[model samples]
Every structure is written in C-alpha cells, then in structure tokens.
Target: MKQQQVKLISLVMVAVFAISLVLAACAVPATAPSAPAGGEAASTDVAAPEAAAPAADSNFKPVWYAPAPHPYFEEVRKGVEAFEAETGIKVEKQIGPDWNQDSQNQRMEALAAQGFNAFSVYPADAVGTNGLYEQLTPNGIHIINFGTSTAQPTTASFAVATDVKAAAMRAAEELIAAMGGKGNIINVLEVLEDPNTALRKQGIDEVVAKYPDVTIIQEVADIKSVEEAVQKVGDALSANIDKVDGIIATGYTPSVAIAQVLSEYKEKGGDRTIHAVGIDTDEMVMQAIKDGVMDGTIVQNPYGHGYLSMLLLQYLSEGYTPKADAYFVDAGFAFATQENLETYNNDILAVTEQIKSELLDKYLEK
Candidate 1:
C-alpha cells in the first residue's frame, strides 16, 4: 500500500508539471504585441513575423508585368507596391525589352513553368495575348489585364482599365472646349497594334463628328517611342502650323511628345495658342498645363489598375469567382487641368477606395 501511494504521488506530480508547462506555452507574453485590429498587418520596412501574415494559400504566387518601360507603368507599380504592403503578398514584377507579343510569351511562359499561378499583365497585342491566356487559364492560372483588355472572347478573368472609348471622348470634349468650340485638331495616336488604340480612335472620331465647328484636319498614328512621337508630331504641327487650332493626344507617348514639342514651339516664338489636351499626368504634361502651353489631360487611374487587379487575384485565390458580366472593370479616370493638377491624384485614389469597397459586393461571387 505504501509503495502504491508513493507511485501515485509521483504520477500526480508529473501531471501537474506537464499542465504547468502547457499553460506557460499557451500564455501570451507581456512584451508580445497584439496584432492590429481588423486583421490588417502593420506595414513596416522590416520583415513581419511569420504568424502575422494572414492565411493565404501557399500557392498564390502572383506577378505584375509590363511590356516595356514607361512613366505610366512606373505609376502603376506604385499601386502594386501598396497592395504588397497591405496584404503581405509578394508579387514578381517584370518589364520586357520591347512591346512584342513573342517576347511576352517567352518570358511569361518561363514564369508559369516556375510555378507562378497568377499574373497581372498589360497585353502587348490584344488578339495575340488571348492565345497566351488560353494556354495558361486551362492549367489553373489566373490572369488579369491591368492597363488594357485583350480582344473580346478572351480567357483573361478580368480587365482593370479605364474605358478607352469614354476616356477618348472626354479628351475630345476637353480639347474642343479649350479650342473655344471651333477649331482644327491634329489627332495623335500611339501604337496601331494596341486594341485600345482602335477604340480610342473610334471614340475621338465619334466625338469630333458631333460638332460641326470642330474638324480633325491632320492625324498622325503608329507612334512607338517618345522620339518617334516628337518627330511625327513636330512634322504634323509644322505642316498645319497656320490652320491647326488645337492638338489632342489620347495616348501616353504622344501626350508626352505634345508637351515637349509644344513647349519648344512656344520658346521659339510661335504665336498660335494651339490649344491642347492629352492623357496621363507626366511631369512634362503637368508643367505644360501650368505654363499655359497645353490645356489639360485625361488622367487614367494607373494606380487602381495595379491595386485592383491584384486585389481581384487575391480574392480569386481565396475561392471567390467573378460574377457574370464582370469581366471589364472600368477603374475610372479624371480630367486634370492646371486647377487640379497638384491634387488630382487624390481623386484617383478615392476612386480606388470606392472600387475596393465594392469589389466583394459588385464584382465577385464566392
């Protein structure tokens, strides 16, 4: 009986010690910080603790790719960085050497082979990009076109972009207003291959046709680079320097060229007002607006393009599906003049916030 009692005491002691160790292990340390409320991970320059990261699937690898370098792509990258900071999801970003479909296919296929499951790509060729999408989506890859859409009947899950037609029409309206409602316009377009370019041209044409007083006297197309834009736009301006009343560029390269060439025209003592409106907020474009050289610009939400596409991809990884007819998401755009030049980004950001709030209810179905 004595030996049994001694054994029982030893067993009880072991149990008690084990309980104490378990309690200690489960206890929250006094110095350990609590996670931020609402489960948003605190953004910091240093790496976050492993436990702080929210439970995204291990295979939700994502990438952000642009066909080539441009100021607009750089702006879109800011939104991507913001998404990474907010969600703690790393995105691989790549800019190809040229705006070529073959280059994009080679690089992106290699990435897919390496296990990237989601991509946000700016389609180099709207029709050709659909082929790559067809190849990838069947194998369970998700693609979101950030800056523009692929041709219709596409395999891309969604396109987060400004409505090309609407933005072009808005640019046309702004230019006509700047021209005092009656003037000759030099229509500048970029890369003929981009699907957006065709829609933009149609929109501009439609808008111009509505006004009997406004005429598009000269049009320059197929602009590939800033240098090419400068040369072509300068040639157009010199050819119609006397009759051209306003210049409008619906593309980024031509927009930047407009600002540069027009600034030089003013410096060289050209007297015509040459009212102008373009798209995107390049520093040169904004400064031209401030200097009264160019009238204004149509500001597309590139930031929203980056952030919203990634947000959708994140939701997709979380088992959410896009609702029927939710393929073309208009990220929204604003018209920026000298009055709102410095503060227009706030408007764009607000659009992003509004869109973010509506994503679950409006665009996605679990």
Candidate 2:
C-alpha cells in the first residue's frame, strides 16, 4: 500500500511539471521581440519630419533698370531704396552703359533667364522697346515705364513719368516769360533717338509760335553728353550770342549742361543776360536758380516716378489687371523757380499722394 501511494505522488508531480512547460511556451513570442504597449515598433516604424515652408517674399524677383547712369536716375534710385526699406522687398537694380535699345535687350534677356519677372524700365527706344515688351509679357513678365514712356500702342502696363509735352510747354513758357516775350531762342535738345525729345521740341515750338516775337533762331540737338552739350550749346551761344536772348533745355543732360555753361558764362562776366529755363532740379540747376543765372526749371516727380512704378508692378504681379482706359499716368509736374524752390517738393508730394489714393479704384481692374 505504501509503495503504491509513493508511485502515484511521483506520477502526479511529473504531469504538473509538463503542463507548466507548455503554458510558458504559449505565453511568450517564440521567434520575434514584441512591440510596445500601444504603438508600432520603434526600430522599423519611424516617420520622417516634414520640410520647412519657403518665405513669402522670397519668390518676388523685381528689377529696377535705367538705360544709363545719370544723376536723375541716381535720385530715382533713392526712391527705389525707400520702397525696399518700407516694404522689406528686395530688388535687383541696374544701370546700363549707354542708352541703346540693343544693350537693353541683351541685359534684360539675361535677367529674364535668371528669373526676374518684373521690371521698372526707362525705355531705350520708344518704338523698338515694344518688341521686347511683347516677348516678355507673353511669358508672364510685367513692365512699367519710368521717367519717359514707350510709344503708344505699347505693351507696358503703365507710365509713371511727367507729362513730357506739358512739362516742355511749361519750360518754354518760363523761358519766354524771362525773355520778356520777345527774343531769339536757342533750343537745346538731347538725343533725337528718344521720342520724348521730339515731343519736347514740338512743345517748345508751339509755345514759341504763340509769341511771334520769340523765334527759335538756332536749334542744336543730338547732345549725348554734358561735354557735347557744352560744346554744342557754347557754339550756339557764341555763334548767335548777339541775338540769343533766351535758352531752353528740355532734357536732363542738356539741362545740366545749360546750368554749368550759363553759370560759367556769368562768372566770366558775359554782358548779355541770356535768360534760361530747363527741366529737372539737378543740384547744379538749383544752384543756378539760387544765383539768378537760370529763370526756372520744370521739376518732375522723379521720386514719385520711382516709388509708384514699383508699387504698380507689385500690384500687377499679384493678379491685378490694368483698366482698359488706364495707360499713361502723369506722375505730376511743377515749375520750380527760385521763389518756389523750397516749396516745389511739397506740391509734387501732394500729387503723389493724390495719385496713390486713386490707383486701386481708378487704374486697376483687380
């Protein structure tokens, strides 16, 4: 009986041990390590971090270009810089060598290749620049004419320049007034290649015609540089000094030249009071006004020209279309004489403010 009891106990113990081994095998994973409590395995299920988005203003690539380096362009450039400072928008600014259409074409094409989509340009040739604009506009590029305009039937979105004809007329009126409405005038013009020169010439001529006594005794044009203008204007003055009573310069280079020449002519004690009027408020010209060597100058809003054109280009770039009737925007103009020299800028700024307030509702289709 005792042997039977011992054997039964031993058999029961062996069965229990076998059952424990089987249960342990079923509870744990046999071949692989288990994942965490609520997620996929760290070693194989990691997700990549998302990339950072690009800056909003970085996509805009605008360029402000002048056909050549001039003091007027330099002042306009100040306005461009002011815009950048105000808006925090960047621009690629350039001034080409000589005022030529071909060079403008080449440089613009190169810039286009580098991904500049907007331009504030002084059109090199009034008629020929349209061909370039045609090419650019088709490819989603925008253009605005500053300082002077391309010819009508143009592809340029807008022109933010002085009314060249009107300004010229004003300059002529000032010159005629100083001449006492009776004198032989010397019409000094800059590059005939520029269409504005022709318009200016016609304005001067029409004004002269109104006063029959004021005849244009000598006309000297194709004055490309200050040096050339000095020589040409000096020659005109020397040749017709006896009869030349009033001098009018309608372009920047010529205006500056006239200021210098007239100042020197006065310093040298030239007896004749050859009254003069010019366009622009060049430092020399302004000084001449102060010295009473010049009668007056037509002060165009070059700062407004620079600031407004850039603002327009920015708007037009962002899906705004020009109104059908919107073309030439006379930025504004004023006659700056010595008497009103200090106050001219305030008047011009008023014009700028008025135009800016109207731009959205009046000029754009949105």
Candidate 3:
C-alpha cells in the first residue's frame, strides 16, 4: 500500500511539469524579440541632415565722376537718382570744382580708395585719363567715358555723347538761311584747341564754304568769362559794324555774353539788320530769342546725356560689349527763335517729364 501511494505522487508531479513547458512555448511571440527591462536595440540606418538653401546675389554700387560743376551736372544727378530709385543700386556722384585735371584725379583716387567697383567719368583732359584707366583697370574696375573721348578707349567699357559736329553744322545752316545765304558772318568761338570747339568750327566752316557769297569776318578765342566774351564781341562789332551781317556764338558762356551785348545794342538804336545764332540755352539766350534779338540758338539735350549715361552703365554691368564705333545718342534740338520759342519751351519740359517717367518705370520697378 505504501509503494502504490509513492507512485501516484510521482505521476502527478510529472504531469504538472509537462503542462508548464507547453504554456511557456505558447506565451513566446513571433513578430517581437524578447527585451530586457528598460532597454532598446540600436538602429543600423540613420538619415542625413537637410541641405542648406543658397545665398542671394550681392548688390553692385557704381560711382560717377564729373569734370566740373555746371547745369549739366544737375541733369546728370537727376538721371542717376532715377536709376537708383528703380534698380535698388546706388550711384555716388562727385563733381570737380572746374575742368582741372589735378582736382579730378584727386577725386578719382579718393573714390577708388573707398572700394568703388565702377566709375562713369567726364574726364577733364582726354590724354590725362589714360593713366587713370591703367590704374583702375588692373583692379577689376570698369569705366564709362562720357562727354569726351580719350586717346585710349580700350581702357573703358563704352562711351555715349552728343553729335557735336552735326549740331554745329545745323547751327551754321540756320545762320546761313537767316542771312539769305550770302553775307559776312563772325564766329565767337570758345577755346579752339578743345575737341568740341574744333568740331563746331569745322561745321561752320563747311556750311559757310557752301555759300560762295558768305565769308567769315573774324574768329575770336579765350572769351570764356562773360565779361571777357562781351568785351571781345563788342570790339569785333565796333570794328566790323558794316561787314558783320550775322554772328554765331559757339558756347554757353559766349552765347550769353553775345546775347547781352546784342540786346543792349538793339535797345540803343542799333540796326536790327544783324542776325545772330547762339549755342547753349541760357536764360539770356532764351529771352533774346523771345524778343527777336537772336534768330536761333543750338540747344544741347543735357538731360538726355545724363539719362543715357546711366543706361549705358547698366548695360555694361550686365556683361554687354559695345561695337567698335562710339555710341552717339541724338538728343534732338529745336532751333529756338521768336517763331518757335514758346513751342520749344513746352517741348523741353515735356521731354524731361517723359525721361523721368521712363526712368521710373524701367529702372526703378525692380
């Protein structure tokens, strides 16, 4: 009986052990690995950092250098301002005291030291700017030569200026027409050595040669100051009173002086037979035209010069290369006289307004 009881106990123990093993096998999961408490496996594959965005392009600031202070400089300033307002770029202008080469060089050097990238220069002396070109070009700086052309143009990106020869020729033709194409005309010219002055004289000479009866009574120079010009013109008028049938004053200063003397002469019972043509648009010349003291004057579109200079700079900055020949911009002129003075006065204002609008719309709209 003792042996049978012992066997029963052994069988019960074996059955309990077998059931425990089966339950352990069922509890194990197929998709998940067994984990120790509070621990995780390391990941084999990691993602790279996102790429950084590219930076924006930098802005370019150019400098403008004028030879001297004049009403023309004011027009240039306006054009530069318009460009800056439109393009989000800056044009810093520095006008020299006069047509002094040394003063201009100093200004240029100072600007260069300030790290200016480009320059638009109206050189006082064409030959003198060659050295400047050499110095600036090596520094990766660009240049635009305006108003005057230098001996070496390879140093500059481009040039834009008036057709001085054509305008002067037109002035001569107008004078010849006023004098019936057959009379003695005196030319009150500026410095003869100046390229502009020379071109104008050539034009006058060419047109006057066409009229066989017309002759040049006298040619005067060094009449830069108004007083000096007036004195020279007065002496010429007094000496050749009968032979002088017409007068052509070539520059603004001379034109104003001649107009003043002619006005006084007309007021003091002088004969109104002498016709006059003047260059430049001084108030005195305008008044003379209005009062019929002068027949016509050649007016330069100074504002156009200013506006176009800025445009040329912009084109160059965009990696443009101009043709071999110089770019001559035709800033149209009107023969201002008593017959068309009022009409031209309005036309000048209208054209300036149009230039302003274009500058704003095209350059500033960025």
Candidate 4:
C-alpha cells in the first residue's frame, strides 16, 4: 500500500509538470508574427521604413521655357523661383539656343516625351508656335504664354502678358508728350517676325496720327541684336540729328539699345535733346532715366509673367479650368519715368497681387 501511494504521488507530479509545459507553449506574445505566403516564416528583421510621402504638386510636371537668354527672362525666373518655393514644386526651366520655332519645337517635343505635362513658353514666333501647341495640347499638355501670346485661335490655355498694343500706345503718347506733342520721330522696331511688333507699330502709328505734326520721318526695324540697333539708330540719328525730336523703342532689345546709344550720345557732348521712350526696364535703361538720357520706359511685370503662368498651370493640373473668355490675362504694365523710377516696382507688384487675388474668381473655374 505504501509503494502504491508513492507511485501515485510521482504520477501526479509528472502530470503537473506536463500541464506547466502546455501552458508555457500557449503563452505566446499577444502579437504573433503573420506568416508570409506559402507558409514561409515571417521575417525576423525589422521591416523597412515606408517610402516617404510624395511632394506637394508632384503630379504636375511643369516646364518654364525661354526662347533665349535675356534680362527679362532672368527677372521672370525670379517669379518662377518664388512659385517653386511657395508650392514646393520644381519647374524644369529651359533656355533655347536661339529664338526660333524650330528650336522650340524640338526641345519641347523632347520635354513632352519625358513626361512634362505643362509649359510656360515665350513664343519664338507668334504664329508658328501655335503649330507646336496643336501637337502638344492633343496629348493632354497644358500651355500658358508667359511673355507674349501666340497668334489668335491658339491652343494655349492663357496668355499672361502685357497688352502689347496698349503699352505701345502709352509709350508713344509718353514720347509725344516729351516732344511737346509735335516733332519728327524715329521709330525703331525689333524683329519683324515677332507678332508683337505689328501691334506696337500700329499703336505708335495711331498715336502719331492723332498728332499730325508728329510725323514718323524714318522707320528702322529688323533689329535682331542691340549691336544692330545701335548701328541703325546711330545712322538714323546722324542723318536726322538736327530735325528728329523724339525716338521710340517698343521692343526689349531696341529699348536697351536706345538707352545705351543715348547715354553715349550725351557723354560725347551731342547737345541735341533727343527725347526717347522705350519698353522694358533694363538696368542700363533705368540708369539712363536717372541720368536724364532716356525720358522713360514702359515696365512690364516679368515677375508676374513667371508667377502667374505657373500658378495657372498648377491650377489646371489640379482640375481647375480657365473661365470663359479668360484666355488673355493682362499682367499689366507701368510707365517708369524718373519721377517714379524708384517706386515703380511697387506699382507692378501691386498689380501682381491684385491679379493673384482674382485668379480663382476672375481667371479660373473648377
């Protein structure tokens, strides 16, 4: 009986030990590792960190293009940079080797192939650029004209540029005023290929017609470079130095050339008071104004051009469409004379801010 009791106690001990082993096996962690497919063991190493969230506006790829390098483009680039900084969207900025539609077409096509879906372009040739746009827009690319507009009936969504005719008329009026409303004028034009040239010429001509005494004695155009402008303007001035009373340059290259040539003319003691008005405020142009060599300049908002075009592209990418009849967005311009030279930029900035405030209501639709 004693031997039987000992054996029974030992069996009870064994049973308790077996139960403890079962409980220990059951007490797994609350979070068991999920088995991979095919009954594979879960990875023991820590999982890699999740990929970083995509950048804001990353879905929209934008390209800012200039036909060629110019001071105006540099200023516009500042606005593009500002947009990038504000929205955290990178712009693929490009400058072509030359201001030709062929160059633009080739480069733009390559960019499109690389997945750029939006473009802010300075139309190299106003009419020719529309052809390229026709090809691009069909493929779901959005285009905004930044510095100048393509010819009418275009595929571009919007033109964020100055009213070229109005600005030119204003420039002419200013020149006429400086000339005391009646004088012989030398009209200097830039590339004839540019569509803006025709409008500017018309503006100047209409304004001149209003004052019968102010005759355009000589018209010099086809100025592709500042050097050419200097040569031609110098020749025209030399020929009419005694009779010519006012000069007007309605293009960027000629405007700069006029400033430079007039400054030199004054420095060389050319006593004639050649009243001059030009468009675009290059540093030399502004200095000429300060020095009283140039009468004034029409300052277009290049910064606005850069910022507003990109903003429009961004909105278009985000499901907003341009409002009806909102194809031409006048970015506005200012006449910068010596009186307001120091503060004219403030006026231009005011214009930009106003336009920005109206983008949603005036320019775009959901």
Candidate 5:
C-alpha cells in the first residue's frame, strides 16, 4: 500500500513537472526585455517581422504583355515604361492581335522560348490562363497577372489589379446617385469570356437590387472589342432611349464606348438626360467627363498594375518569395469625375506607393 501511494505521488509529480515545463516555455515568450542592451532606447511600437530585402537581378528578363491595344493598356504601358526607366530592366513588351486565349498561349510560349523568365500578363481567358501559368511555373518562369486574375487555384505568383467587384459596386452606387436614386439603367459589359465580367455583373446587380427604385432596363454582355461595345451600347440606348435614365459600364471597352456614344448623343441634341458612369479614364472618357457628356469613370491604377507586377517579378526572380497573404494585390481605383479629372491620377499613384511600403510585410515573405 505504501509502494502504491509512492507510485501515485510520483505520477502526480511527473504531471506537474510536465505542466511546469510548458508554462515556463509559454512564459518565456511573454517575458520581454524592458530596456535595450548597452542603455539603448527600446522601441514602443511592435513592427511586423521584416522580410529580407531583395537583391537586384539585372540579368532577369521580364515581359509586360497585353492581349490587345486599348487606352487602359496604354496607361498600363506607361507604367511599364516607368518601371523600365526606374529599374533599368528592359522589358520585352508585346501586344497580341486580339483577346484570345490561344493567341495568348502562343505568344507567351514564343516569348518563353526567347528567354523571358518573367511575365506580367492580363490573362486572355480567366480560367484558361491557369493552364499557361501551370506550364510556365514548373519551367522556372514566374507569371503575374496585371489587369485581371485567373480563377482561383491559380499558378500565377500574384495579380496586380483593382478589386473588380468593389470597383463595379462603387460604379453602381455612383450611377444611382447621379440618377437621383431612381432610374432605368443600361448595363454595358465587356467579354463574358473573362470571369471578371461575371464578378462585375454580380457587383452591379447586387448594388442596384438594394435600391428598389433602380432597375436595369437592358443588360448587354460579350462585347469583345471597342467596335462591338460602341455598336451594342448605341443600339441598347436607341432601343431604350425613351426609358433609359442612366448607363453604367464596368469594363474598359464598354466604358469608352459609352463615353463616345453619349458624347455623340449629347452633340446630336438627344433631349434625354442620360447619366452615365463608366470604368477607366481613357482620354476620351475623361474628356467626356470634362465636357459634361458623361458623369464619371472609375480610374483604376493600370499603371500600378503594370509597374508593380514587374517589380514583383523582379523580386521573384531575385529569389524573393511571396507570403501566403500575397495573392491578389489591389492596385486600387477612384471615381474620376470632372471634379478630380486632372488630379485623380495623383490618388492612384498614392495607392501604388502605399502598397509598395507594405509589400515586405503584407505581401512578400522574404
């Protein structure tokens, strides 16, 4: 009986020892030095663990590719140019003939063969683009999506673009406000092939549904080009000219198309006061805002999309790695009305700077 008692006490002692060790281990983290060594001042602010600074990779060749030429892409090209000037890293820039998945695949493969190690691409097709990334990544090629992202489970390292759904929702809110909270809207969208269009469509529809007074009179999709966007938007407006009180376009092509059609409508003495909100500050779209032809456009940081993607690619090539949190980097956007048309660009630039400052902690692990 005495041996059994001793054994029970020994087991309790072992349990207590184990618990004490765990407590001690936990307490070590909680106990921090109150003062720095050698009488140095201690920091009051706790900063995130700093990632190692990336080494410059002069030999890495990166490409900034677009599926087609548009004003939005032109702005993105300016950012690419800025990156080239800033980094002294020459980018092999290429523009595809059209926004087609097969074209993107062929062009990217050709570039890859020519020794481009990094690419900042606007996926020609959101779902289909992943196949290209899947092929490239295993071969040591790093791909970044500039304007839009592929569908989830992407092989691309990062996507530098505006939050399309947020931008679209904002556009809806702006449109509804411009129409005095009640209107029949003509919703113009770009290609249905890109999944961003669906997110954008959902964003717009969700926002409009909140206000019972707002109704989408006509919604058009699958506008593949500026020509198609213009013709289709014009037709939609004509068909609902008497009933349409507002037009909202969340895609670049459709936005520019809306600006042109509305400007013509205003010039042709169309008596209907159609308030329009569109995406991207194409020179024509901005001019429309300035000329009072359209209400406003959403100015996304296309420059940031190009510049940051290249910057990230540079880091990636230099052996810097992305944190798990670093998936979609929101370049940001602003409503470019006549009020801020000239200076709105400054706001977009600020967003880029803010993201850059946070990239080490918020994005890249190393």
Candidate 6:
C-alpha cells in the first residue's frame, strides 16, 4: 500500500511541473528588431515647420542716357549709385558725345530691346529728341528729361530743372549788386536754339530792364569753340572797353571762355576791371572764382538733379504716382565766390559721400 501512494504523488508532481512550463512560455513577450546604428527613427509626432523662402527679383532695369560727355554724367552716376544702394536695383548709363543724336537714338532703341523699363535723358535738342521719347513711351518705358524741355509735352514723366530762369536772374542780380547796380555788360550765351539759354537770356533781360544804366552792349550766340568764344568776347570787350564794366556768361563752356579772355585782357593793363558772373559749376569756373578772376558764379547742383531723377523713377516703378506739385524738385543753386568756394566744395563732397553711405546701408546685407 505505501509503494502505490508514493507512485501516485510522483505522477501528480510531474503533471504540475509540465503545466508550469507551458504557462511560462505563454507569458514571454515578443521583441521588435532594432534600428540600424546612426539611422533616424520613424516618429508619429508632428514635424517642425519649414523656413521661409527669399524674395524674387523685380527684373526691372533703369537706364540713363545723357546727350554729352560732361560733368553731368558724373553727377548722374552718383545719383544712380544712391538709388541702387537704397533699392537694390541696378542702373545702366550711356553717355553719348555732344550732339550725337543718331548714336543716342540708336543706343536708346537697343537698350529698350534689352528690357530697360525706365530712362532719364538730357536732350541735345528739343525738336530732334522728341522722336526718341515717342519710341520709348510705346514700349511702356518711363522717360525723364533733365537740363532741357521737350517740344510735345506727354503724360510721361519730366523734371523742369531748378528754375534756370531764376538761376540766371539771381546771377544777374548779384552781378548788378557787385558793380554798384550800374554797368554796361556783355552777355555770352550758349547755342541760341537751346531752351536753357533762352530762359537765361530772359532772366538777364528782366534784370537789365530794371536798371536803365545797366545796358547789355552785346549778345553772342552759337559760339561752339573756346577759341571762337575768346575771340568774340575779346572783340566785344575791346570795342566797349570804356563802357563795359561787367560780363555775364549764361552757360559753362562760354563762361570759361569769357574768363580766359578777361584774364588775358586784365594782364594787358586793360582799364575795365570786368566784374564777371557766370552759370554752372565747371572746374574751370570754380578755379576762376577762387583766383578772383571771376567775381562770382551761380552754382547749380547737377549732381542733385541726377540723384533726384533716379529717385523719382524708382518711386514711379513702385506704383506711386507723383502729385503735380511733387513733379518738380527745385535743387537750388548758390552763388559761389572766393569766400564761398571752400564751403561749397566741402558741402558737395560730403553730400556725395553721404548719398553713397546711405545707399550701401539700405540695399546691401551685412
């Protein structure tokens, strides 16, 4: 009986051990495969937002075409640089030789073909250059005329330069004051066909009309060469040496020529100590003012003219239409004598540098 009981107990213990082993197998958890080393894991979490894209280019080109190679080009170039610096827009300029109408017209057409959207011109002749404007306007190009006016006024943009008439009048008034308000004067004018010259002549006429004693003894026009200018002025001075007390030159080239004649005449012991006053800020004119050869000159800031024209063009491109009043920016001219030459020179240089610095700061990235 004891042997049978022991056998029963062993069988029960074996059955319990087998059930326990099956339960342990069922409780074991399954393991997933590991990701490869250095590989990113797939995540169900939301992704981070992307960075913003850069701005697109406007693709608008601004071109400047001046009629002649003159100081005006340098001023325009500076203004163009200022505009580009401020707006990140590039400016292309073409300066044609004096009176090169055919070349200028051809160049304008070519630039228009190259996708130029705006142009600023100093027209050589009002009648001849109107056709160039007609061509440009049809192409949806903006045009601004500097130093001259157009024959047929169009809705297209135009800047009548600092009251050139006022500038000349101011010059005349200053001359009259320097000569004790009474003197016989010789007026040296630029090309008679030029609108600028006509306006200046009107100013002189106005001032001279006020004082009966201040007579304009001679008016010479179309004096292209300096030699011819000197000859004409010399003859006028010699003929009226006793009567002529002052000389007024209405433009840059003629002014320089007049100064040369006056300087030579003065050295030759001519009795007439001519109080010379001229227009525009050519280097020769400035030097003459410094040397006391010229009593004074009316200085126009052509650099400002170029600078402002580009600025106006940029405004138009940006969809801002100018009010009639804002269309004309009167960049005022100053009278420069030996006393004021240093101040004017410094002011111009400083303004130029400031314009450049402002341009770089506004347009370029640090």
Give the lDDT ranking, best first.
1, 4, 5, 2, 3, 6
Residue by residue across 55-115, what tens digits does model 5's lDDT show? Answer: 5586698999999865567667767776776666789999898988899999999999998
Q: Which stretches of candidate 2 lie over 4 Å from their true place?
A: 1-59
List candidate 5 stretches off by more than 4 Å.
1-55
Q: Write the per-residue lDDT of candidate 2 for residues 240-353, one digit (tens) a residue.
A: 978889999998788888989889999999999899998876678888988999988888777778878887888887778899878888898888787886666667767867
- Put down candidate 1 lDDT per residue, 253-277, tens digits, no spaces: 8999999999999999999889999
> What are the root-mean-square deviations of the candidates from the true structure over C-alphas?
17.1, 27.9, 33.2, 24.3, 24.7, 31.0
- Candidate 4 C-alpha lDDT tens digits along 81-106: 77776777989999898887899999
Give per-candidate clash totals. Answer: 0, 0, 2, 0, 0, 0
Candidate 1 residue 232 C-alpha distance from true site, Å: 2.0
Measured with C-alpha atoms, the lDDT of residue 155 in candidate 4 is 97
What lDDT is obtained when candidate 1 is compared to the true structure? 0.85
Give the Å error, residue 169, model 3. 0.4
Tens-digit per-residue lDDT, 51-160, candidate 3:
22112114344888898766556555655565555555667878788898888888898888888867878878877887888888788777777665666545876554
Worst 10 residues of 4 by lDDT: 36-45
* TM-score of model 2 vs. true structure: 0.79
Give candidate 3's root-mean-square deviation (CA, Å).
33.2
Error of 1 at 115 (Å): 1.8
